[model samples]
Target: MKEGNGLQIPAGMRDLLPGVACDQRQLESRCTGLFTSWGYQEVITPTLEYLDAITIDTGEEIRDHLFQLFDRQGKILALRPEMTTPIARVVATRLRGAALPLRLCYAANVFRYEEPQAGRQREIAQAGVEMIGAATPLADAEVIALAVEAIKQSGLEDFQISLGQIEIFNGLMEELPLTVEQKSKVRTLVAKKDFVSLEELLNSYGITGAPADRILQLPTLHGGAEVLEQAAWLGVNDRARQGLENLRQVYQALASFGVSDFVALDLGVLRGFDYYTGIVFEGYTVGLGFPICGGGRYDNLLGQLGYPCPATGFALGLDRILLALARTNPPARATSAVYLIGGDDTAAMLNKATQLRSQGLSVEIDVLGRDEASLQAYAQTRGITQVQYCRQGG
Candidate 1:
């Protein structure tokens, strides 16, 4: 292997220049503000947590994706693969004594060791919220509705939320005669929407009849409220029926919130996490093959952390959202920047810059002492429009 220059970043990471950085910051601001307006106080968790703590209920896949390191005491510390687990830990310990249904939000970066591609990265910047101690369809609906609004607030209008209840699938599985390994394989196939393989696997087990039929029909059971009616006609078990009813209540609540237009009933939807006990959803926008945001009701995660409370939340991939926006509406290169070109009087330039900053303007003073031509050239290259000269006397 040949050694290269030091300018190269890791494969999964890239440098975000000024304009892109601005866009990311703006997106974060808009989302955090919306979260605050919805009465969700911002919470910050450490970037790294104990490997055991982070891997609480996360399955083998997520555990394998963790970027782990050993600390001084030889304890394994891993960069958090996601925020929900850490927030659950926080609720279990710090916020344990706090009020019920804690509405907390966060905007931070997470790490996961993966074969990075377009949306999936080694370092992911995300923002999301968690509502602790609430275990109702209304709570699920609330989070789903908020996710819709958050995506809209990010200037993404052409998006849809695929909503599903894991219990529906669990309910269907309850009636099936299969070993634990078989069930795990079925879940993997369903999550992948690999109907062909799923059918073959089920047929090999001699699992026929209504339950098998429903399992096969799960992925196709997506669309409007009528999908629910179709699922009901499938003669599902008690648990499946309960999940359908829960989906109905959530749909009604979303309608009440005026966000039902963005939601669709997806009975086959299953999140990757093992903690989801009820509603799970993923948000997709036009032009993006993968979901830009996802989360669900994890009524059991807090219990795993010893908190024992029902919680629900979602996280939006800031990078993916920006990518979607860029595809739809490319950010303008030109920025509203005012460059204060100073002559001999650096103090006057500083004072003017301060004054403009006080008036909420993005002002920059010429620290390099560039001449008029050079300053204008630099400003033009940087997409800076406004340029003012600060002389010695002024």
Candidate 2:
């Protein structure tokens, strides 16, 4: 039997109480409204998925962070670590022939067995959109535009989306005279932004000349349009060079949407090769070490799942955005319903509540026949603007 820990909840899990819980709901509602306006229909996926499916494309790195259990038949199961893979599976198997360029959005909870921190919840709330079947620069730019708008609409003043293309790194690596294993090690170092160790590692490999120099410089080639221009001149293969060209077009497309101010180039924002194939970006704000939002182009994922399609998407850490908003733009307090005070007229108060509710107002009828003055005081405390007294025989 499970041990009783009544008020003591498990690590990394939390309860969203009255005020903040309401704020979260309001935020989600607002996002849903925004998504609807953008023509992205919402969809809900299962919270539980098979363990093998989750770990397949993502590699074994995620296995340690998964919360797994065995089913009655001994089949392995796990809570969703993320949404993209599950959604990809849905597109592949269930909605195989659905319309192309499906714009699907979701507001849901995902679980990961991670260390609890300020914004890292074991059970996290995420709101995101998947733009599948379109592989053009416009598709990439569209999601970035939506992400920028969502943050701006969320009342966050100071935040930026760091944009980068994975192919640039992959391209530079391909030009190097290193084996696959050696390139993987170098990529890992650059991903962590470990310039010192990366330099030493390059030296250990006896790599000299342009490829080494350009590889070292790739991580630091960030910020503004200069980076893209610099990319055009970087010493790399044609494939990586073509990746930069693609990112340049994306940047130009973003400018047309008038969101260039919210974007910056950071080739260092390496997300990983397992999923994100092309342009990867991260949303960051001052004083927050983690990105509030992240997503990228995955032209290969659907193919891996048996469907051949190009797609781009993003996922916002709703809890992390809430935390940031709390620190900066604190949400408004929740309101209360009209309180009905009863004095031996509970039935009358019920009738009054029904009348008010029918008129599209919230109402709370008294059950214990609380006094008028006391009920009024309670209403005032709960932010209820209106109150009615139902007296007996009146």
Candidate 3:
């Protein structure tokens, strides 16, 4: 890249100008408001942390995406590629003894070093909530319900939260007659949804009958509630069945909580983070090709940080959400009612402006030296609600 590129920022980063910034804040506010109402307080973690601390539970894929550097003292450091890890660190160290079932939320920017593409950014804005110390299906249901409500509140329609349980997969892998390496390979293939490759893999392993059939069946087992029933009878093992039952309870509870219409069961829904020991899910809409929101149960994450507690949470990407909203219901330009008065009438304008501001109205004194007719035209063009002439000496 040339130095003459006119104040160029690195690739995968862009500025959020006025209009989009307004929408971004509105989106963040709505999410944080919903979190606050649910008693989840917000936390802001630093953008940089000791590299090892950030990479504790996140897998190699996530670590590879981190932008790493060395500090003056030669200690390795990284810009946080995701927000949850930072939050988990704090919960384990700082808020460990604060309380049981800590409810926390944050709207913050995260950085990554990855090839930029649609719905992806090097610097992304995220609004998320994490509930710590709660370990039950209801806690899972709470986060999922909040997620649905958040999308609904954002004015997004036709989005679905595909819920899956890592325990089901874990249980099945434990029962499979495959090598340790083979099990990891199966997980990778299934997560990618590469059925052909998965089939080839199973065939190569000399696996047949129900084990092979069930493995292939997973990536496509998404639909109405019946899928849960089908999962319950997959015959994998006691552990898998127990996990499926737990998932079923959470799904049904979400229905009773009134957000079922926006959720579906998908056995193949695997989140990349290995810390997720139980249910996981991602939110998707019609037009956008990526999940706008995602999260799951990470019962072991805090323990790795020396804060042993069960937790669940999810994060919505503000930029992708804005894109989804734009594709679906493109927001109208944000507007406020304002009356612009002409000329320099500081005393009177100040008094009037003060009164209008006090009343929660937008008022502006003409600083452009625009004449009465020109001022009226300017106000009209700018959608100023009213226009008046404030003679200079009056």
Model 3: residue 375 alpha-carbon error in angstroms: 1.8
Model 2 root-mean-square deviation: 2.2
Assess each prediction's global lDDT (C-alpha) against the native: 0.87, 0.85, 0.87
Candidate 2 wrongly placed segments (more than 4 Å): 1-7, 177-182, 338-343
The candidate 2 region of ten consecutive residues with least summed lDDT is 334-343
Candidate 2 whole-model C-alpha lDDT, 0 to 1 = 0.85
How much lDDT does candidate 3 score?
A: 0.87
| Positional deviation of residue 329's Cα in model 3 after best superposition, in angstroms | 1.3
lDDT of 1 by residue, 1-394 (tens): 4479576788787788878998999999999999999999998999989999999888887988888899999999999999999999988989888988899999999998889898888999999999998888888888888899999989887999999888888988888889977887898898889999999999999988777888888888889989988888554678778888888888888888899889998877898888888889999999988999999988889888876898999999999999999999987755657554455578877888888899988887787888778888888887777887777775
RMSD of each: 1.9, 2.2, 2.0
- Cα lDDT of candidate 1 equals 0.87
Model 3 residue 246 CA deviation (Å) reads 0.7
Assess candidate 2 and give its TM-score to the true structure. Answer: 0.94
Pick out the ten consecutive residues of candidate 1 with the lowest summed lDDT: 334-343
* lDDT, candidate 2, 1-394, per-residue tens: 5568866888999999888888788778778788878989898989989987776676455677889999999999999988888888888888898988899999999898989999987999999999989989999999999999988887788999999998888888776789978887898888778999999999999987776788888789889999987877663678797889989999999999999999999988877546778899999997788999999998888888889899889988888988998888677775746554455687888888888888988777777657888888877888887788878888
Off by over 4 Å in 3: 177-182, 335-337
- What would the per-residue lDDT of candidate 3 be over residues 222-243, giving only the tens digit for each residue? 9878997777657478778888
How far off is residue 162 in model 2, in Å?
0.7
